[model samples]
Target: MPAEAGISGGSCPDFIFPPAETPASDGMTHPRNPLAAPVPLFYTCPMLTTLAIRDVVLIEALDLEFGPGLGTLTGETGAGKSILLDSLGLALGTRADSGLVRTGAAQAMVSAGFDLPADHPAFALLAENGFDADPGEALVIRRVVKADGGSRAFVNDQPASAATLRELGGMLVEIHGQHDDRGLINPRGHRALLDAFGRLDVAGVAAAHAAWRTAEDALEAARTDIENAARDREWLDHAVEELNRFGPEPGEEATLAAERADMQKGAKLADDLVAVGAHLDGSDGGLAALRQAARRLDRIAPEHPLLADALAALDRAVIEASEAEDKLAAAAEAMRFDPARLETVETRLFELRALARKHRVDPDALADLRDELAARLDRIEAGDAGLARLEAAARDARAAYLTLAEALSEARRAAAVRLDAAVATELAPLKLDAARFRTVVETLPESGWSPAGRDRVEFEIATNPGAPFAPLMKIASGGELSRFILALKVALAEQGSATTMIFDEIDRGVGGAVASAIGERLKRLASGAQLLVVTHSPQVAARGASHWLIAKSHDGLVTRTGVRPLGADERQEEIARMLSGAEITAEARAQAMRLLEAA
Candidate 1:
């Protein structure tokens, strides 16, 4: 026991389990072997691994720890604990509330510390960031929120995002409260509770959920695919028909466009050539008259130089007309009209424009339509096969999911029986004898994927005989829920309790023996987990391994709240005050002392 009490050989020697952190010999139940006499199992203090708060709503300076067994926090109603939790929640990946920033603060910082047990999953998270955390070393985190409205988080002083913090936080904590944003309030939380109680080992559960979700998503996508196919089936068929009719070659448009332009101007060019030829011919055209003039001039020019000049001018005119005729012929030959080619051009242009109007696309994009329309039609026609495949796949997936879910439900059912009994046993001392605790596992195959299961897992209760059994969530008053939660925690102790469990005056309505019972259960739970309770009940506080006093102080205008653990003598007096209201009576002090000794 002495050796077990010390830190493992890897950690610093002075950094031992805190003395007050150990379990007390209050003869608690042996969760492993309940039939045997109750045994007081020894436990070492849990390491303080990490803490952080940043510019998060109302947080000024955030400092805390990865604490162990029952580290209780106490303050007045609005002493900022809730805000602290909100900041932690946000840092862990809840939605970032820019409004959380203090009015005068610029940005908020949140951070956490983790002590990896050489194999904690958080180590992998750290490794992803390239930080090689030492084995057995505490993973320290710090976050600073700037007064100017910006924030930063660090793991071992290395930068990280709020998302990473959130991912890691999920594995680190499971906060339970009837009305909290966490826990059973969200239906999505149901799957997690089942998983936790089912004893699933990490990757297995995650993988199963991944596969299930993928299958579910595929089915949904297939439904949409089918709907869309039906919607466009008619349009797709029409488009494919039109595209096939045109049968336009891929590059036909460019070739036809060039040919059409040349043809449109061909007649004008030919007309010019004909006019020049006629003129060049005798009397009928320019060339013929020029030739006739040249002949007359030539006959006279045998002696006159002026006649020679007139013949040269007529020759120049004839040459010009001959050149124009050749130019027009060349133009006509380049156009080279084929009736079939012209008809093809007109047909293609008309088809392209008609398709363009039909599909609301540019003529140039007709080729694109041909491919698109054919593909769409093919898909619509093939949709029967696709939908069949999807539905088949969905059925298979749902079956697989149901198989596991049913198996889990069986485990839960068996566990629920024990759970109910265990809770009932705890309630015995709490004075709820006639009150029955029941776990009702309702499997609703019709209800779509809830985080919990196909089954609506609700805790049920019959507080009084003949009273209709109703869901624990709805039927139990706040006090009953607290007690129910406590009893559930007691049953789950062996599975491992949260590092810290805080019950704010959970012992409020009960007194005398019931207070003692609550204290006893807390003590029993504290054996494996830490229990922090804020209480006015002396019985409850008497069972605390350590006591803290939350008080207010004023230094000038600054009002500050502080917590300090009470000494043994101080504990005696405080318990007396709690027992006797405002005054500390000798009898009350004596009773407190006896309670302390009895504890």
Candidate 2:
């Protein structure tokens, strides 16, 4: 065996020996002959390669290496086997107890290492929790518990929460005890297990459910809008009618104001034109007097040169005066105002300004407001038809969801029947022949519907023929419960199973043929994965590819628990010890040899 606690290439080591040429249905390699070929360092399955502990209960400092296949640990009643399991649980983020620390120790620490396949679920979980893990790399989880009961956790040497460790541990290993609440024993996981066994796809049902929710939401929103519009129906109709009658146009306010200003200016200039018309009215006016003086000057202009200059000036003045009079007459004609037209323009401008104020908008935006009000009124009028369409769509979506859910429920029922039969076949071998196993698939009410469909799945068992079926946890005997769990595990095989499994004294109450049967099934299970069995049964220990003897030794001052890895001869001696009470006899050795050979 390698000194380090991890995977390495070598010949079939004492830790892992498979029987001659057996094909595994779970898609893991089983060596054709243990002595002939070298065992590769990497296996398709994930493996718990190492567990290191310090100052935890009776264990002081311990480092143990592991490998693939069934590895058995055996010890006396007070040999600290429970301590080993507790240490592993601490590393796996179980509750931290200060009492677990050793005497005079400040803290207890445990670290667990695993070699995983590229596609293991733990890698994805690490990523989800903000840790980076690569394919083909070993994962390490460490936990430290202070004597005061505080704890800290690390994943791959990076700081993490205990919750994260717990989640990752769930994916890496499953520890099955008589009263275990996790894995197959938990009712919550039974549905997923059934689906995995049947390879059922739930994506279609989930999509249908989501579609139904979206359609219902849309229908509800449309109904709310219609109800709100109905509340304002009278106001909208009145507003639309008022706007339509007024017929406000873009820029109409500015246009009306400009026209009114021009009319008022013309009216003011009418008085001024009348005053100017009086100055050029007749012969006594300025234009007639200038014409008379110009005629007189024209007659005297030929008598003297001075007289001619005067006549030219007088003629120029008369011509300019006549042009001014003509312009004044035209101004009077253009400035002519009618009171009726001014009054009409003023009234229209007032109405436009009043409408703009009532609507709280500029005149230019009044036209857009009119259109919006009209649209609201139209929607209120068509509210019943729109609601009908939306209701139909919602109904269709609900129908589709029901159809898919019904199909899924049917498939689950069929899968449940097959699973029950499979579990039945395994029960007899585990010495539970008289017990009955059942997979219950019950339909839930509509209120209980979900993306997983409207069905509830649970695993129930009856220990006796006429007994009522009850949950596994409620079984009267721990040994029977453990046996039932083993049977179920064997039947399910690799379906929804963790890569590594630990059975804590699963063979506690049985021996001889039954113990051998449990050992055989465990070995078969280990063919595709890793298993660590804590056993008192010599038969089960004899079947181990590797054996560990957990012993508690005391020096003068302190007692400590340690694990010793056994070679082939050492394993045989341990099995002999287990067979014979306190002393090893010749017959026990021979029997141990027979068991080993049979394995």
Q: For model 2, where is the 10-residue window of minimal lDDT?
A: 1-10
Estimate the TM-score of every prediction: 0.52, 0.69
Q: List per-prediction Cα lDDT, in the order shown.
A: 0.61, 0.81
Q: Report model 2's TM-score to 2 decimal places.
A: 0.69
| Candidate with the greatest TM-score versus the true structure | 2
Error of 1 at 363 (Å): 35
lDDT of 1 by residue, 1-599 (tens): 12232233231222222111222223332121212122222223333355556455555555654344554444445555556556556555666656777656667766655544565556776788677667577766555556554556666667777677666665555444434434433344443443343343334334565677787798786667557756977876776787788775666667767777676556446666556556555457666666777887778886877778877877887787778767766766876566677777777777767767877977677778788767656656777787688778777876776666666666666545545555666677776777887667667764554434455666667888999877656655666667766766665442322244556566758899998998887776666554567676788888887777655566795544444677899888888887887678999999999999988
Clashes of each: 27, 0
In candidate 2, which residue ranges exceed 4 Å CA deviation?
Answer: 1-44, 229-382
Supply candidate 2's per-residue lDDT for 439. Answer: 86
lDDT of 2 by residue, 52-130 (tens): 9999988999999999899999989899999999899888988889899998899999999998878777887888878
